[model samples]
Target chain A: MFRAGEVDALIHLGVMHDPRARPAEIYSWNITGTTKLLEYCQAYRVPKVVLLSSANVYGPRPDNPQFLTEDAPLLAAQRFPQMRDLVEIDHLVSTFLWRAQGVETVILRPVHIVGPVHNAPSNYLRIPRPPVLLGFDPMVQLIHYQDTADAIVAALAPGRRGIYNIVGPGEVPLSAVLRELGREPVQIPHPVARPILSLAFRLGISSFPVAELDFIRYVCMVDGRRAGAELGFRPRFGLRETIHAVDEPA
Target chain B: MHTAGVGLLDRLHKLRGQVPDDDIAGRTQALVVRGNEFAMRVARWLYRNYFRASAFGIEHVPATGRVLFVANHAGQLPFDALVICAACFLEPPTPRLVRSMVEYFVPTVPFASYLFARWGQITGTPENCRRLLAAEEAVLVFPEGARGISKSFARRYQLGEFGTGFMRLALEMRAPIVPIAVIGAEEQAPAVNIKPLARLLGAPSFPVVPYPPFVPLVPLPVKYRLYFGEPMTMTGDPDDDDDVLDEKARIVKSRIQSMIHVGLREREHVFW
Candidate 1:
């Protein structure tokens, strides 16, 4: 209500992703905060809105396609309560997008975003000699922190409106990224690592939730074809460059 | 008979120094599996002398570029994928490797996971498959997934539910789908009994077998026959209707099933 005439575009990137926080707190903050923001946008006639969504919404499933698109089911919330808040926010924003006449909404789902500030999946990407499951080497899809900033900037440009999967260039094995960082892979047997990681988390030794370990065990890649086609946004860094720039294990 | 094991190491020694493009992990992982020389050689030997595997339609496989080989998963483990990989390498005009899509739980095994990556296996993610295909690498997928490989001995050769992801990927990537039927592998480690402990064992199927407890769990030498049918041309968007996806998958399944019938009629014996 305050910036009625001044603000024409709104970039919604604020999220409370701390797993330690109470789910109820996270929900109200995201949901209610977003509603107020949308209310302001509506009151102020902010025509363009861009949201930074996550590829994690596509949950890790044995049957998940190698790369997910924007149309893929947001199944992560079904399993991880931690993800429910993001999905709810997205559902609300999307529902708002269509119901309102003048507002054009763009939702972008990006893969593991790594850089100065570490997200959930990025935290796993940095630690030296992280625990790797014995027989699995899942593909790692990442966007540089700078490139993510660039994507958000691109999303706010005038005429783009729709859901898009924003992925970085190139694909490599997670083992490759670990090696590039000079970290030794601590191999853990799959059947056993599940509980051990959970216990480690419970013991306050590890920050990553054990549930998200499935990403490392399986594929969590997303196709960025739509973004490339529509937004005209291409990641400046390739897989090698992003990995080298993001995590310096040494 | 002399072992080809040592002999294969000799070949890998010559192909060494492919490290220029590899990242730190790819290089380190190669050290673990020795560029996957030993396992590949063993699989090659198994496909050649052990299984006496013969191929019928490798010509359908493109000498270059991305092509999807949809095969039935059997033999309890991925012995079927191994034999298929062997066929691609051993009897080929172009000695390109076929990257078989593996399960997420595969990395649970420490040593084997390294070998899988070194040997050119990628996790079965559409994005992974799509990338490999875009790079023009040959990718193989078992649409039946763990279900087919773990099927009961009595239901052997019965194709399980065909996952439609491969079909959509085929359409999306615009790669031709080659339906392949592998015979004899179903009997390699036949599912004599699917143990109730499959869940406890954390495997798709824990089959009670005929082998004694102390006996080495080597897959019995079964004469193998592989049939590669014509590649089907895919049309439509990858984001097509679920029914369309199901029908597309069924079309490929029926084709493979028919090929299995042909292979069954032609296979001289399960074991020579």
Candidate 2:
């Protein structure tokens, strides 16, 4: 519905992450659909475009530094092949950001967005007894879904182009977040958790892929100083509020 | 939709419990305070009765501001780190934390993963060190890294080849480097490293002490003497040549080496 000189900004937030959806379907919607949308934006002379990317593009790595900057490589797809779609979409938008002469592309990679949302982190927290890998409690960063929305709105400001890691209240250990939510996590050994999760996924009992277990095992936090400096964005939520947002009713 | 979210936040803010208004670092420090208190009690017990550790030149550690405590690393385990941490907590003008750079593999371990971070220990990364230093916090580094820790018993008190990372960070952040000489840790677990075995086991080093329980799990109770040298400040390009960085690093290394010699001469026995 884009008419030339009419649409001021095109905020692209459409990306598929349905665990049940086929990879082919996900690729079509996330890649092909985004390509068409970017093409349309370019043809229609949209001045600004904000893409909602994720800090998971860096991947939950055991060797990751406490805080990853924006310049860090997007290597999420190295281990988990399923993450290729999101990584590809990020690469596509970033390429478009540099190539598109007129369109101002802003890529915001926020950390795990919690709150009254049906995302992986929030949904995992919602579980009364989430499965935690035994002996591995990595520090995790979370942004309230509202805070994430605020970051997008901040990016919509004119001249705020380039990538930014939108952090929230702050980081805490996985156990601390679980304690705040009053979750009694079932500790599973890392070696056996994979086969069990894989079988459970095959049996249609669990939606979490075996590859996704690394989220609870390794750290993938990011530094948000750039966002704070450039976009003038900061989360209004406290750490306790951010962690408790998962339990808030939708 | 935006209004609803804001309203919900405002409502939650009103009904807030005793949630501490602090960022991650502050929250982690709060946890560290609690954890440090308990750890200090135990560490003090070990320092006084068990190891009989004596900390000298404690006044060199500044009561405030960011400082880099560069020390010698030894003991099959990190009792040296513990003793250094305990020394800072116990003997400083005001009890302060000496945040040590833990190994990357620590995150994979169970209790140690989060406990180390809670107690203000961080993974050994330039970014982590730079951030902590900028925040005006003290950080501890062992430039010898694994090589110094897993050295054979024959090489006790001999300084390993120091890496130049900490020197660059020290110069970049403008934080003074406090050279620490931890004597006794080198002799705590006098084990020989079997490189082939370490490779087969996919471990850092395979150390086997001469005594029973050859793994060096429980260190022999040796007296720990920590000498804190005067804080040294170097000014130069942090991204300078490796040779330039190494030259500065050698200065710190030699300082620690000389302190270690003095400490060795002063001690009458290992288990005093």
Candidate 3:
């Protein structure tokens, strides 16, 4: 597959991003399928590789700082199995980079990437009456989808290989973001929010899984400094610009 | 009377100037959190008319430097914190926005969380504290946590066991610890007993104030006197033994307690 186009670097932007996908289906595409692809890359001897990971790997823990570094432990997967697979996939890729004979790998973990196609947070925010956990105004960082592509391209530029958090310059409170979107949130107690979200998803009303709702409940921000300095990748859209992209109508 | 009204409004416009205008700055993070301007204005009004708050030893708060204000948390909610911040912002000897280290459970609520973030309130995490200190910003901490605020009416004036994290953080960040004693806050909405009803709401505490029994959340009118002590410096490994950390915490606790005693002695009346 790799020798066909004289491809010097292979970037894996394909991952089961939507948590609403059935567990088995998501595992097949994100976990097992990703492995099969990486194995092929090794067999085909692809010189360089880059994997798109989510900053959600950090998890929405009470202790998580507003800005997190790449070194932070990947705990998001523990809370939501959906995230668990991404961390597992990251673990696999990281291990491969160290042991693989010739592949130079880079992992990019970006916060909510907004664009024409709706992502988790964007999809959640679009609900006419979005449900927010009572109390948490966890700040949300946005990166333009194009910016993510730019980061992947920057990683393809060669040099160092490892993990980099591709993030934007500023963050707006999740509450303010909702206000900016002109959406009224139904405040639900945290304990009840999970079950309600689960039921809503079961009814096919919710676009994403219940576990991903933690993003709206706690702070899980990532520091994008390394991406800018090491990969020469910077986000083009400012805070309001990226948010407005999500607010765009269908 | 018309001239007096205009003068007051003009003075208020000047007070609004102290609140960082984040829109023009294009900065996010803390600066972007201009807080609820209306809420702040109300807080300002209360800082003057309600509490009639006054500050002493303001010079101790450095003109520009990373500082941690370790104050007694009381008055059911955080009246002490509001009045202290108000005292700092309103008076100009050392005017600086003081970021309050909010309890971990604080951000779990809706509008309140939004207001706190707008007011530059960060979760009481060591990482957040370190970042603020590194940036040379002032942070207000209630090391007593719920223990101090939830204390029964009898123990209102007493400083509870201080959390060792602040001391360890102070040691780690090398940020000077400024002990603060907020008088009269203990008298406002004094919680006689804190019921475990917070579990129902998934909240941290649900203190039971004796007055107005139905509305325990409302605080009574009380005068405030905020005393800022000399900057206390510490030296030692932040990762020192538990006993060492506890001992360090005790020194600051004692300092605040002594200051509180003086504040209590000086205040002629609670409703002054």
Docking class of 1: acceptable
**Residue A221, model 1: Cα distance from true site in angstroms:** 1.4
As for TM-score, the candidate ahead, 2 or 3, is: 2
DockQ of each: 0.27, 0.39, 0.49
Q: What is the lDDT of candidate 1?
A: 0.79
Candidate 2 docking quality: incorrect, acceptable, medium or high:
acceptable
Measured by lDDT, the strongest candidate is 2
**Model 3 per-residue lDDT at A131:** 83
Per model, kept true contacts as a fraction are 0.46, 0.60, 0.50
Error of 2 at B59 (Å): 2.3
**Candidate 1 stretches greater than 4 Å from native:** A1-4, A121-129, A192-194, A238-241, A244-250, B1-39, B60-73, B95-147, B154-181, B199-202, B214-217, B228-269
Ranking by TM-score: 2, 3, 1
Q: Order the candidates by lDDT, highest first.
A: 2, 1, 3
Q: At residue A114, what lDDT does model 3 achieve?
A: 84
> What ranges in model 3 sit over 4 Å off?
A2-7, A17-21, A36-45, A61-63, A97-102, A124-137, A174-197, A239-241, A244-250, B1-36
What TM-score does candidate 2 get on C-alpha atoms?
Answer: 0.90
Interface RMSD (Å), each candidate?
4.9, 3.1, 3.3
| lDDT of candidate 1 at residue B200, scale 0 to 100 | 77
